[model samples]
Target: QKEVEQDPGPLSVPEGAIVSLNCTYSNSAFQYFMWYRQYSRKGPELLMYTYSSGNKEDGRFTAQVDKSSKYISLFIRDSQPSDSATYLCAMSEASWGKLQFGAGTQVVVTP
Candidate 1:
């Protein structure tokens, strides 16, 4: 089984809503973390990156990591239809290709 477990949510929300996403991992060796957003038929683009147990915010997006609990989360404020995408949580013990990925959660923000 994969080291990470995440709900593959087809989470639907209205415009200007807040979008919440999370993931859990079995590996404590995971020191690096990232969140990727993938649009339909497109590659995932880096959305957030955090290395420690804390929260990081960039604009309307926030990423939180709790290493003690082996959990991580992402929040998107003021959701928009353009924000509709698949969110994949990624991690690595070292860096680069060692990344482990979670089953992406599908999100839809309706107008």
Candidate 2:
């Protein structure tokens, strides 16, 4: 188990909405954020990445990066059942640095 607790999930959401997903860690040295979504047996696909601190948005997805708080978040808007997957959070010292994973969160977007 990790101190990384994802809220409103291992989650279930209706086809088009959900609260933000959060992740917290103890490593203050981490400087990069990576979010990935993996389907039942498929390889994980990278969703987004953020540097030290700030928010980044791509389409309906938003990533909030706060290094000072040792926190990061991924928000999915207008979710679809296809959004249902095992989501993974990773942190690194640099963009290509060694990756450390969070405990992982699974989300279900219901139809």
Top of the candidates by TM-score: 1
After superposing candidate 2 on the true structure, give the runs of residues whose Cα lies further than 4 Å from its correct spot: 1-9
Model 2 weakest 10-residue run by lDDT: 1-10
- CA lDDT of each prediction against the hidden true structure: 0.94, 0.83
Q: Over 4 Å off in model 1, which ranges?
A: none
Candidate 1 Cα deviation (angstroms), residue 18? 0.8
Which candidate comes out best when scored by lDDT?
A: 1
- Per-residue alpha-carbon lDDT of model 1 for 1-111, expressed as tens digits? 679988998999999999999999999989899999999899999999999689999999999999999999999999989999999999999866488999999999999
lDDT of 2 by residue, 1-111 (tens): 564445425788889896477788887888888898888889989999888899999998999998888889999999998899988888888777788887668898889
Report residue 105 deviation for candidate 1 (angstroms).
0.2
Clashing pairs in 2: none
